[model samples]
Every structure is written in structure tokens, then in C-alpha cells.
Target: MPKFCFVADLHMFARRSNAERYQDQIIKTARESELCILGGDIFDFRWSKYLTEDETAHAAVEWLREFDSQTNHCQVHFLLGNHDDHPELLERLPFLEQEMKTFEWSRYYYRLGDSLFLHGDVADKTMSAACLKLQREQFAHGSRTELHNRLYDVAIKAQLHRLAPPAVYPCKRVAKRILNYMDNIGHGRETGIKHVYFGHTHRPMDHYLYQGIHFHNGGAPIGDAPFRILQRTVSLNDGENGLESRIRE
Candidate 1:
């Protein structure tokens, strides 16, 4: 049986302290698991707009490279999120591009014996209420960059409202609506997958036996909780049969 660690929404940025803590968590988890799966949003947008070649962004990149090297027993898989903009960054990294599997905003199906793992975001909507609130506050304060930032924020919020949550103010409400939609679609699909895991909502939830499917969300690694890891074990009987899934704090 092989064990895996699921982590998502690290949102690594210029904050040196945060980055150090995050690296520690990743290294620690990697040591204990067969593989580490990065759900998405590993880098924050702060470094994208600012920071040059000789800045902290490059240092952060180096940190990731070293972390990859340290985890000999585990392979890291990266699923792309909205925040990850530059493919070149990952491309330039050594030992990482080949070691990581990067997927777009789509479904990923991986089978370990009879169990399946999914970085669920295909049917997920966008932007939490917290994100929207921050945008509104910035706009109200008449911040210098408010106009440009608000434009993009409004566009995203509007799209999310149209697709998932009808209301744009409360992100939790929007997340719930999106989750319901995902559940419906997952149940309708015939993927032969017994367990599905995802992150994007930042809301930690565990629900099994929903229309004959098990659903799990790997919550945000930011916030009060540094990171959340989902652990699961699987076995094959006569070449195909047994699997076990568990979530670890």
C-alpha cells in the first residue's frame, strides 16, 4: 500500500516568514508520505505583479527546488490554479518540471488500486466573499490601484455569480452553491471512481455516500490552519480490489 499527502492553496508570496513555515510543512509531510500532491494556488499574485529577477521571487523559486530535491520518497504533483500565471517559472526550475505534473483548470483522475484522487475544481465557482469584501474595501478607500484591481475583481465576481453563486457578496454562499453543482455533476458521471478530492473553496468538508460517491476537500494551507493533508491507502486483491481513504490534520 502506498500513502499520499494532499496539500493545496499555499499562496506562497513575498512574506519570508510565511514561506519558511510553508516550506517546513511541505518538507515534513513529504518525508512521511509516498507522494505529495499540490492541489493548486501554490504562489500568490503579489510576486507576479512585483519582484524582479534578483528579488525574493527567485529565492522562493529556489526554495521550491530544494524542497523537491529533499523529498526523495515522494513525488510532487502540481495542479494549476487561477493564481499560477507563469508557466516559465516552473519550466525554468530544475528537477521540478519533470517531477511535477501540472494540470489546467480541469479534472484529474488518478487511480491507486480501487481508489481515485481528484483535485476537484472543474465545477467550482470563483472568489470567496472574503475576497470580494477586500476588493470592495479597496475600491471604497480610493486606493491608487483600486480602479484597475476592481475591474478585474468585478469581472471575476460577475462570472462566478452567473455560474455558481447568484449572490456576489458572501463567498461562503457562493462556495456552497458551487459545491452542490459539483456534486450533481460528479454523481452524473460514470468515472468508476470511488473517492474524489478537491480544493478551491478553502472550506474543509468531508461527505461520503453522496449519490454513491465519496467527496473530500483539501482545505486551504493558508489562514488559521497552515495546511491540510489527506492520507489514503489502497490495496489490490487478485490484481484489483481494496482501497482505504483517510484525512489527517
Candidate 2:
């Protein structure tokens, strides 16, 4: 009955030239859909340290505020990702809280006519633990120097060069193993959820069935062309018996 747009892994810091254009596209997408779901990694990395209370951070905050205003009519749900450190980024702006909701390392078991919407990160317990540990360490460190940031950037670029074929993590075997293990538990036999949507792997895949469950990854919005699903639900009410169904694209 309600239509929503799902997007994730924007990696907003990766490219600056198209930042405004990307924001416009997101706003447009949100306007088109009744709701917009952000899968995570929306801010690129822990922004508080580098940005401080400076103009850069303020500008970024304003952009988000404007974007939220543009999508005031649409409900926005944000699932925490490895890259999003500041959950209170939008709280500084008025009326933004009503339009957007942010979750911290949690899973949203949304049931819309027997269809489930999951952010995918909740599927992997081990990786999630590791990522949390890393985040905690980063937070405790207080701030990173410019040199340290540059060095880390170099290391990431080097790693990317080595892991070109997969275009995601360097080791495909490890990646698959981690994903498989996560999928096994998150969608365990007892969950009873029929359809699930998630994004973190940045790979555009649909109709992948694991065990007895259906899995769909919406992919990243930064690469290729942004892709989202439009779902329609049909409900049948018959006195004591009710039937609900969904169709997605």
C-alpha cells in the first residue's frame, strides 16, 4: 500500500565534485517515494573528529537539514552502518527528528503486508561485533590528526588496488564466508519472515534465496546508477480471515 525508496553506502566523502548533484538526486528520490530508507555509511566515516564544530561540519549538517526538509512529507529511516558515527547529526535541526529515525546497531523487523525490510548489517554477528569494537576504539581515541587521516586514506587506496576484481573487499572467499555465516543466523529457521531487503555489500543483487528465505540487496547509491525498489501490497479482509501480499521491483 505504501511505496518506499531504499538506498545505502553513499560514501559521501569519496567524491566531492558530485556532492550537490547526489543530494539533489536523493531529495528527488525521497519526494517520489512515500518513504526513504537509508541503509548506512551515509557520512563516510566518523565525522566529529575531523569536522569538529567548523564550517565543513556545519555545511554538511545544513545539507542534511535541507535534504530532510525537501523530503518532509516522506518518512526516513536510517540504519546504523560502520561509517556513520554521529547519530545526533540531524537533531540540531528542527522538525528533522519527526521525519527521520536513526537506529544504533539494531535490526528493524518491519512487517508491511508479510514483507520484511532489514538493513543487512544485523545478519552478521561476528562482523558486527568486530565493527563495534573498532568504532569504540575510534571514539576513545578522541581525534585523528591530518597526517593520520592521510595515512589511513593511503592504506585504503592500496587495499582497494589489491582487491579490484571483487570491487568490494579484497578477499572474495572471506567476504562470502562472512556473509554466509551472517545470513545463516539472521534469517534462521525460527524467524518466519518471508521477504527481506538489505544492503552493505554494495553489490546489486536480487532474488537470492538462502535456506528457505528470500534475500534482496539494494546495492550502493554512489556507484553505477542509484537503484531502489518500489513495493506494492495487497490486502484481503474476509471477516475472520485476512490475507496480505507484496510485489517488489
Candidate 3:
């Protein structure tokens, strides 16, 4: 059983003290776990909303060198979240240059064991109060490419190309809508996905079970919680554990 640390939505910015803290957390977590998975939004481009373009870029990549330099002992996997502009990130961050290997980025989602790891934006789009079910149904047959573009539209592209700052995620509405989505998506799909871990909700679910799928929302630093640590045998809270079985599984 491998140990993994799940953190998301750091929305890292240019403050010296903040950058230092982010680096410390990464290095420390890496040393303690088999791997550290930074789910998304590692860089906060939302600063562009208020800062000059150059300032935004500088602040976004301010601590990359030091952060990258200290990761020799721990393996880190980067997944581009809604806030991260993948192409721009590689160009701006020297450590993420094509030659860099110790730290790599996954354009799409990652898979490990029986779980599928994504940044959680896919389910985000259809989460509004109206047409939630209809939206998911409409996108049911859509390709991952299409879904990516749509999700990006809401998460980033629509907000003046600026990502959101840390906000209390998994708000009551988001949580309930997401749980409904988990029910509709059919947890045991071709990938045999019993669990899906995604960070981006900024809401630390700790554990949310719905429709046979174990949904873990890795909360961000938007509020009180810094991060959540997950081990192989961690037990999930069963608020509605049997609900999934009643549905299908």
C-alpha cells in the first residue's frame, strides 16, 4: 500500500512568506508520502485581474526555482487545474521547461490503482441549480476534449481569463449537486472507478459517498483547512453509504 498526500487549490501567489510556506509544505509532504499529487491551481493567474501583466507573471512564478530545487527526495506530480494555463506555465517556469523530468505535468487526469484522479472541473459545470441533470445528460456523450474546453470556460476563460482566488469550496449547493452528479455518472464505469479524488472544490470533503462512488474533495487553503492526508486504509464516513447500493452497485 502506497501513501499519498492529496492537496489542491493552493492558488500560489507572489508573496515571499506565502511562497516559502507553500514550498515547505510540498517538500515536507513529499518526504512523508510515497508521492505528492498537486491536484490543480498551483499558480494563481487571478492576480492578473489586478496586477500588470508582467507583475502577474512574475508573481506567479516567483518561487518556482527554490520550490523545484528542493524536491530531489520526494516525487511530485503536477496536474493542470482550472487556474493553470498549461502551455503558459511551461514557458514561464524554467523548472517546468521541456528538459525537466523530476517534476512533470499531466495535461489530463491521472489513474492509480482502482481510482481516477482528476482536478474536478468536469463535474463543476453541470452543478448549477437549474438544468443540473440536463447539463450532465447533454454532456454524457461528449468527448474529454469537448468537456475540457467547456469546463475551462467557466473555471477560467469566462472570468476574464483570470482564475478564482481561494474561496470556500464545496459550498452546500456544490456539495449537494456534486453528490447528485456522482449518482448519475455511474461510479463503476469501464475504468472500474470505485473512488475519485479531485481537488478544486476548495471544499474538504474528507469523505463523501454517493451512488457507489467515493468522492473525496481535497479542500484548498481558501479557509481554515490547509490540507488533508489520506492513507490506503482510511475509512470513509457513511452518511449515505447504502444509497449507492440502492441505486445500482
Off by over 4 Å in 1: 14-19, 46-61, 93-95, 98-118, 125-189, 225-227, 235-249
lDDT of 3 by residue, 1-249 (tens): 467676667766512113334556667766777666777666665432324445555655554445555655355666666565434454565455444555555643555555555666655654432343244234322113445545644554354222342343434444455545444544334435556678766556655665555777755553233455444422223332222121100
| Per-model root-mean-square deviation over C-alphas | 9.7, 7.0, 10.8
- Write down the TM-score for model 1: 0.58
Clashing pairs in 2: none
Cand. 1 Cα-lDDT: 0.49
Superposed by TM-score, candidate 1 places the C-alpha of residue 29 at a distance from the truth, in angstroms, of 2.3
lDDT of 2 at 146: 71
How well is each residue in 90-205 modelled by candidate 2, as lDDT tens digits?
A: 33433444434521122233334434554544333344534544543454212356777677567555654224424543233333444454444453334344445666565555
Clashing residue pairs in candidate 3 (N, C-alpha, C atoms within 3 angstroms): none
- In candidate 3 the C-alpha lDDT for residue 8 amounts to 68
Q: In model 3, where do residues sit more than 4 Å from their true spots?
A: 14-23, 48-65, 90-97, 127-188, 223-226, 229-249
Worst 10 residues of 3 by lDDT: 240-249
TM-score of each prediction: 0.58, 0.59, 0.59
Winner on lDDT (2 vs 3): 3
Best by lDDT: 3
Native-vs-model 3 lDDT?
0.52
